[model samples]
Target: MEIKLTDQLDQIYQDARTIRHHVFVEEQGIAETDEFDGTDSDAIHFVGYVNGEPVVTARTTVTKKGVHIQRVATEKAARHQAYAKQLLEYLLDQPMFEDAPMFYLGAQKTAIGFYQTLGFEKYGEPFEEVGIPHVNMRRTHSAADHHDR
Candidate 1:
């Protein structure tokens, strides 16, 4: 698998769109308006490809405190194979996020356990976002943190 970073929409836009389409539009019935926020223009995106096929995609926006991970998704056929996990790992490894004090993501209720396995801890109470229950989660990084895994 190879992970690439690009700001040009042409680079990975379609792949990211496809993942979101599969997960939100086709699978969850979310309207297109809710999926494509204006944030993409400023956010950093990561695309993971397996054998030249785009299998996973994620985006992150850096703030003063940390990087916020969002829009993480993998093609249905790529589920259970750790493609999303690998994409996240690659995003966290980027130099821009290397020294971030913490990494945060708004995780879907059903997917909380997966992020927990990655060291993210749920914060406060769960709330609804776009009609889906979600909770804020964050992972603080320390020198001793085993991020390699």
Candidate 2:
């Protein structure tokens, strides 16, 4: 599967949102109010596609410190398929984010090691986010990491 990054109206945006809503709201049981907070408008979103069908979503926003990645989700049928990883890798390759000083997120505890293997390092003590345990993790931009991709 190939992942593509796009703006809000590419139809993939809706597909991405469907994955997010399912993963975060329905399956995870997060409240609709908390899950659908209005920040997507200003952020860049990505969707992973398999044979032209979107199946995963992830996004990032540039901040004063660096790029902040968030909202990674995969449709139930697409879990374990490396789709979110593809979305994240493509996101990191974008010109606006590729050379940022850092990329970071508050990752769910279950996925911490997954991000760690991808170069993110955990920093803070774990805390609850969306009623799930999460930890702050960051990946400092390194030429070697970029080269590997």
Candidate 3:
């Protein structure tokens, strides 16, 4: 697996969008309008490829609170292969996030456990997002703490 990160809405970013489209729009029935969200132009994207085909994608936006993780998806056939996990672990160690206080995401109910294994903790009441049940989760960042994961 190869993971690429970019700020430009170039080919790598487009590949990320394709995976999101498949997972969120086609498979999950999310409205394209909601899934695209006008934020991609500004967010940093991560795309993971296997055998040269993009199969996993995620994007992050640095906000006042910290890094805001969003649009994480892996092609159905690629699920449970650790691509998303590895991409996120790579993302956290990037130079851009070195000074961030924490990382957070609105995790779908089904994925809460997956994020927990990455050191995230639930902190808010469950809520609906894009018509799916979700809960807010955050992981405090400590250079020493992250390495042990």
Candidate 4:
């Protein structure tokens, strides 16, 4: 699989929306309004493709608090393939985020363990979002520690 990153709502981002539409909106029953959240225009999007078809998507927003990871989704048929993990690893390796002090996300209850394997730890109590349970997870970045992966 090849991972593509983009800051604009270009073709790569459009492909990401397709995957998100399937996994987040259609399958998970999340309202389209809540799923979009009007933030994609300002976020850095990442899309992973297999055989030229987009299968995984995630985005990041650089804020004063840290880098917020959002919109993580993988196509239903592509689950358990580690595409999300590889895409995130590629995202962190980019020069722009390599030294970021922190990274965080609101992980779906079922995906908490997956994020944990990527060095994120649960912080605040669990909460509900868009009718689904989620927990805030964070990972502090250390160049030395993460580089070993």
Candidate 5:
């Protein structure tokens, strides 16, 4: 698996869009207008490829509160390949976010277990986003704690 990160949408825009289209628009029935919120231009996008085929996509943006993770998806055919996990493992290796106290993501209810395996702790009551049940999850470990584990 290969994980690539870029701020330039032209780099992985098509692959990312394709996966998102399949996962969000087609499978989940989220409106394209709601799924594509026009923020890709400024976010740090990640695309995961398996044997040269892009199969997973995610993006992160820094906000005043914390780093917000969004649009994490793996192609339905590639779900068991762990491409999304690979993308996140790559994030851990980056030096920029080293001492952060927390990391946050709004996890789809069906994927809560998946994110928990990566150290995110689900909190609050379940809420709906994009017409799907979701809950906020926080990786409560300090950066050092996460890396050490």
Candidate 6:
């Protein structure tokens, strides 16, 4: 699989849209407006392709506190293959986030274990966001956490 960073929407527009549609629209019934916030212009989008087919997508928004990961999804065929994990590792390795003191993401309740494996810890009580239960998670950066497989 290969991953690319693009500021231009043209490069990842289709894949990112499809992934989000599957996760937020079809599967989760999250409103279109909530899923497609007009923040793409300022976010760094990452798309991962396997065998030349886009299989995973995610984006990062730089905030005053840290980098916030959002829209993380994998094509159904790509699930259980570690594509999300790989995409996340690639994101963290980017120079833009390498020195950031914290990394944060709003994780679906069902997927919190996956994030914990990467060293993220839930911060507050779960709350409904767009009809799904989510909790804020944060991880302080450390050489060890980044180096782990």
Best by lDDT: 3
Better candidate number, 1 or 5, judged by lDDT: 1
Tens digits of lDDT, candidate 1, 8-77: 6775877877888898888888888888877788887788899988988988888987999999988889
For every candidate in turn, the CA RMSD to the true structure comes to: 1.7, 1.9, 1.5, 1.6, 1.7, 1.7
Candidate 4 residues 18-119, lDDT tens each? 999999999999899998989899999999999999999999999887899999999999999999989988876678976678888999999999888888
Candidate 5 — which residues are off by over 4 angstroms?
141-148
The candidate scoring highest on TM-score is 3
Higher-ranked by lDDT: 1 or 4: 4
Report the CA-based lDDT of candidate 5 relative to the real structure: 0.82
lDDT of 6 by residue, 1-149 (tens): 89987777875766788888887788888888899988888888899998888889998888888889989988776899999999987887788787777889999999999998778889978898887889999887773366474
- TM-score of decoy 1: 0.92
Q: What is residue 125's positional error in candidate 1, in angstroms?
A: 1.4
Compared with the true structure, model 4 gives a TM-score of: 0.94
- List residue ranges in candidate 1 displaced over 4 A: 143-149
> TM-score for all predictions?
0.92, 0.91, 0.95, 0.94, 0.91, 0.92
lDDT of 5 by residue, 1-110 (tens): 88878888675877888999999999989999998999988788889888999899988887766677899999999998778888976775466665555678999998
Runs in model 6 lying further than 4 Å from the true structure:
143-149
Query: Scored by Cα lDDT, where does model 2 land?
Result: 0.82
Each model's C-alpha lDDT?
A: 0.84, 0.82, 0.92, 0.89, 0.82, 0.85
Task: List model 3 lDDT by residue over 1-149, tens digit each.
Answer: 99998999899999998999999999999999999989899999999999999999999999999999999999999999899999988987788788999999999999999998888889979999888999999988763396465
Question: Residue 113 CA error for candidate 1 (Å)?
Answer: 0.8
Question: On lDDT, who's better, 3 or 5?
Answer: 3
